[model samples]
Target: MATEVSSRLFYHFLGALKRTHSFSNFSFPLGLPQTSMSYSASKTWISPQTKELETWTKIRDSIMRISPRSPFIPKTFADWLEHRLAIKEDQLRKVVRKIARISGRDDRQETTIHPVLGVKEIEDRRALVLARETIWRQSLESFPGRRLAPWPSYEEYKHEGDDRSKSGYRRFLPLPRDPGNVTVNWKQRKPLPQYLFDEVGRRTTVDNEEDKEPGLDELLAMEFVGASLILLLDS
Candidate 1:
């Protein structure tokens, strides 16, 4: 099932790559008549062209990052799609910013009169979240007739089975009962040392006491050597 999903994702990614590659050959008609149009109209036209340039620059950067020869390629197809979705979301944000600037409106507004046209940061985030959810659902759909079960609460799990000692909480199964589950008793053989529970400061004090200190004889020998050096300097 995993292999089948992987193959499908691989082909889908290849198709996307082909489409992105084709975009490189396509050029936008930016050569408009400067004299025929008013200053405001020309400004409106130039803004889109500028946006396109920025889009292409971003695309080029993405291409460089996800190059075939690059070592840091996404491990899974979902990850690759997520990367593309992030790029699209960024483009959407730029569009939203441009629209806000043109309309003289604050970008903080969550929603507007027009649902499709009026996109704000919050809406973009919501859309991104929805897109991620959709991707995850689609991936899960590969396993036919198998839906993920919700996690059981502690109270529910504890009282699941009749037998308290042998079943229920003792024989707790976190996953679906497909593969066999093994139960192992992780009992300790020996008791822990009493010093293990000692306070950090106490432990440090003990360590300091255990460490060998400089002898009094060694200190006197160093003092004598210092005196001899002083006498030689005087001479």
Candidate 2:
């Protein structure tokens, strides 16, 4: 994760390159200005770009004092940080909107409106809640018939004189004395699909760095897996 200090430092370096240029024997690949004087003799104050760079440098230094990570690499960290800021800003706006709604001070009428939008806030909220509840009930009711829990008393396979009276498989058996249903096994958890398991194992374990074991993408996907994304599957 990128810190605030490193991002500011990177931008400050950009501003600094823009300022304090020497006209004598000057060269710039990034299109920097070639100035007649490095520093103005008339004023003790620095140029606007230089001042901006200095201000950001001070702020960066202050943030670094609090942040723990060091040896910052600007390219990867700063670029990722800009993306993270956008995600965070969107989240913050949602929070502010929720707060505004709660306080009865929401500015719903004044803000920019989408041309084809159909639903209002309260309607959207109600619809979302209803949809979530419906999904929850559907999941609970839609138990996979073959997935019996692995209990101490229950047999994975049928035994001689084993009572089939209470067995779900026996009740749902299409034919009398169906040995195919009798031999079939049941599991508790919804096992990952063949492809998903293969992908997850390869991405998280086999393809990852051997010493480090797992990399960013695999770790992120594993950590952020919400229960809602999971579905019933065979082992």
Extract clashing residue pairs from model 1: none
Candidate 1 per-residue lDDT, tens place, 1-235, comes to 6545644554454444323433333445545432335655633333323333444555555767778466565544455545555565565677679888988976688874675435633322222432322212213331333343334435435544434545434654433222212231112112222221121343233356547554444444556668677567759
lDDT for every model?
0.44, 0.41
What total of clashing residue pairs does each candidate reach?
Answer: 0, 0
Displacement of residue 52 (Cα, Å) in model 2 is 28
The reply for model 2, stretches above 4 Å from the true place, is 1-75, 105-235
TM-score result, candidate 1: 0.18
| Model 2 quality (TM-score) | 0.17
For model 1 the local lDDT of residue 133 reads 22
**lDDT (Cα, 0-100) at 4 in candidate 2:** 62
Backbone clash pairs for candidate 2 read none
Worst 10 residues of 1 by lDDT: 184-193
lDDT of 1 at 132: 23
